[model samples]
Target: MSQPTSRPTTATRVYLARLKGTAVFDPLGDQVGRVHDVVVVMRLKGAPRAVGLVVEVTGKRRVFVPLTRVTSIDAGAVITTGRLNIRRFEQRPTETLVVGELLDRQVTFRDDSGTATVKDVAMEQQRNRDWHVTKLFVRRAARGGLMGRRGEGLVVDIEDVTGLAVNPAHQGATALLATLEDLKPADLADVLHDLPDTRRLEVAAGLPDDRLADVLEELGEDDRVSIVSGLDVERAADVLEAMEPDDAADLVSELPDAKAAELLERMEPEDAKDVRRLLAYEHLTAGGLMTTEPVILPPEATIATALAHARRQDVTPALAAMLFIVRPPLETPTGRLLGVIHLQRALREPPHELIGAILDKDVEHLLPDDDIGKVTRLLATYNLTALPVVDEDRRLLGAVSVDDVLDNLLPDDWRGADEEITDQAMTRTAHG
Candidate 1:
């Protein structure tokens, strides 16, 4: 097989259904594999474009063959450059398997017609030798069922399809969220950042407060700001309140002065107050990095009570790692700091035992003015995930989490590096 002498016109669209399962021939017309799936790379700002084809070779092993290797698309056959690598196919962060992710998926038309199932994707090879998904062939269910056994099929441009068309075999948003639930906040945030804007917002809107806050905290400043700025004041305030005070303050500080003030005013008085206090501190100081919402329990409270509070759905695992035992006034910026109880101690203690009895009194603490260097030194020296901040009067102020410290310590483009690492790890896990 050789390159086709003539190319198809713009009016001629090759449907994915007809191309899939067809024979693939090498340069000398030797059959090597069969086309199993099409691979495309999605862009944040544009329509996805085909990059390669997943071909099932002998021994039923599938491999990815770049579009550059394909010389021509003929009737029921794909002509290639004659060379094929014998390795299994694995998707990258930028790639999506069209058959696994989009074919037979439900898609909404821009004109608001009822949802239709994707029958095939129409691809047109551009002059640049690139294959782009230009249209979609979708089948809509008929109104009546008994007599109308067939559905209406229409070919529409890819632009007309709303949001990402997920695989029909997979559950929708709920399933997506469930699968992503176990991912670290940073990893999940990376996934969200890669998604199309509309889908990103949709996923963000569906997440509960704690989960959303965690994910937002893990995102870069620009990504976090973009996502939050898109929300209405009420929703934005709600998400901020759900986040650790320091992270929330950092995000709000990036907003325009007027917009930040408006959001703060709309937030709950307590939550707003905590964020405002953090905002007042220098960005590199302990006060700026500390969260005002660490798990605080009264000195008289029992282990059971502390454990129960820690177990609350609203409390994040990071925050629940330790409990700060304070005197009379239980809230932060209150009575003298007493001691701290690690979760391990709380769990091993008797249910009714007072937290005061198990307090680890020699706790290393920090003052609001302490710099990031000092904070990091103290945390690393003590091997601590959180360290309490105290006032001149030794009143408990807030606690800085290790995550915040690391955020400041790492290079500015840490998020990009993290995303790459996470993607590679996930790809390995998927293939294995």
Candidate 2:
């Protein structure tokens, strides 16, 4: 959260807008996950009662943690018992995703003081140890305003707002998105998945190209397709261009042939060319799975140059794990493949040393037709995070990361590994 608040005092009223993305810690002072969103039970005549939290654990899997298990909610963290359910979270029929559903609601002050968009909702603990959304921080304008003015803002009891139940025909995402601006792409994708189509598209449109591309890669295929389809062709093309060549190709492959062709036509030629090349191969094969943008350096490059390339933020950790050594034309499908250099070896060598002198020439190559089984075996056997794929001429084409292999290998619902909760501490686990 905010660095342990510099001290540990419980908050009387917690604003969920601030709680999104906060750290969820076990009592032993170990972090287990993050607060993705608050789950609430919406009432007909009154405010929604806080049910629990949707905490995203490792592996991007989310589980429900009952508020009853929440020992404290301070400015910094939500401390809980170490015991937790390992099962996946499924929204109950009567539950509402407060962060998604309640925020940004266009509401009228009960006294008719004027309307405002809900910026954040505050929950207070009751005598019975229950929690309810008793207050709201709202703005007199849409976000600041439709014309971008610095609108009046205020915090008042929830009973003072009349439109809490109104589902506006159109809603602004700026405020809600701002609250979640720090979320990782995967976590953001989860939030988007739970939102209605219109809000999801609104939020998606607000994200920068690169950020949206990353989320697209993490979304379920159906959601990905739905979001992409909802966008006009040009926007879809831009998003695809921002993705890795292999990922872009996979997304395009999911579309109808004509639509895919149109998107490819609109993309920048160089990016389109790489994706088209990848599309030429069958799924699960080396060419299909490998990203065309792997680090490709010539033998003549210095160890220093290789290290510099590895340090670039654009290069993924898996891609940087191994450097593909080639003869000339460092781009994929370049000159004949020469050897490979492990990043560790590069670190040990003098910066001035030639990469060629220390290259691992014995490294095996994966052909375009090599299946995923072979890719997995090779990566696992050598303890390698990435492996090179090459053309028949032994020219470097691309490299496949272990993550890519896992994506193809896992079941469609792998993100939510749905095992029932086994922890005895969660015997009273909230509805899945």
Candidate 3:
């Protein structure tokens, strides 16, 4: 058959649902077959680009047809570049078939709302002149659905779909991770740890640096080591850089000396310095547990400024609960600690009031060499979530949060009980 004589002048957008089972024709106006599925190349961080279509040809055998050969899609018919190969379709590792793998899948939206069934996917032409799945059509059960009525339907941008709950029959880690894109790093880490080694590594390969760093922090030491070492040297260094200095140092400390040094050399000079500083302290001491990234501001800053800083998305709830006031040369390993202001005080104080005025000077602090026992005792005595650590000259080095202290004080298997603890907490909250 020759190429189709008529073709659409401009690219058109169409839903995947409408395209499936559509009749496909060659250039000579001959009926070839029907589209069995759309094939897309799954990417680690962006929309999956359309590679081609799977068409059910003679003898009901399916074959791959590259999108480059497609001329147009209109009125339930697809026009092709006129040539067709007669080989049976078999999906490669990098490819996902929309009809077979993605259709009818359950997905969680960006807002963490209840799951919705995927009804269709909106495809658009990209800058590269290739078609890509850019949005999703979802259906949610509504009030009327209880009586056999149709439910609400929505068209959402692809980015808004945070997670996919893959059918167990699909059984690909990449597909599972694609749907789990919306999970918190900690939650994702928990899931990753439970996966088999090869699958875990495959999923880890797709996570961005910041997300990987957060997951690494939540993972057990052995799992962290495994994931980090599995990544290429440059990527490993980037992931470490994205992590808190203390956490990065802890992970690096567990690695072989030669490998650790190589990764350190590959890291940014400033980030590597922070990690090296934490590595200088014994793991059981105050310095070892402290995070060098605590929220610290000069004494002259106002309560409003302090509050704004606390509200930043990057600041964890525990770290945002207090602000560290420091004197001149306000940098990491900052000059003498002036005072601290708890969030509670910041809220009640006038907006323009300087933090120095309401500083909590009687705060209990830690020396770098203080043992974990002493750190725990001080935190308990003061009822504080965090305690700053300083050197002999009173230069603020870092602050250890209660969670970190607990992690150290608890038995080695404490992490294994985390899910049970979380479940119990949820149960208690439900009852009350």
User: Model 3 over residues 215-289: C-alpha lDDT tens digits?
Assistant: 998888888899989998877887787787889999999999999999999887878899999999999788999
Among these predictions, the greatest lDDT belongs to 2
Tens-digit lDDT track of model 2 for 330-398: 777889988899999999999999999998988877999988778877887889999889887998899
Backbone clash pairs for candidate 1 read 1-29
Q: Which structure among the candidates has the greatest TM-score?
A: 3
Clashes per model (N, Cα, C within 3 A): 1, 0, 5
lDDT, candidates in the order shown = 0.75, 0.78, 0.77
lDDT of 1 at 138: 78
Task: Give the Å shift of residue 203 in candidate 1.
Answer: 3.5
Cα misplacement distance, residue 351 of candidate 1 (Å): 2.4
Superior candidate under lDDT, 2 versus 3? 2
Model 1: per-residue Cα lDDT over 1-432, one tens digit each: 121222233434466666778899985689998999888755443556676799999999997776765766754688885646564666643356777887878887777655778877767876644577887777775555653335777777788877554343323554566556557778899999898887787677656445688899888877788888887777677778768788899999988899999999988787888889889999888999898878888888888888876764445566688889888576788789898999987899899998989999999999999888788778878878889999999899999888777677665675666353334433322332
Span of 10 residues, lowest total lDDT, candidate 1: 1-10
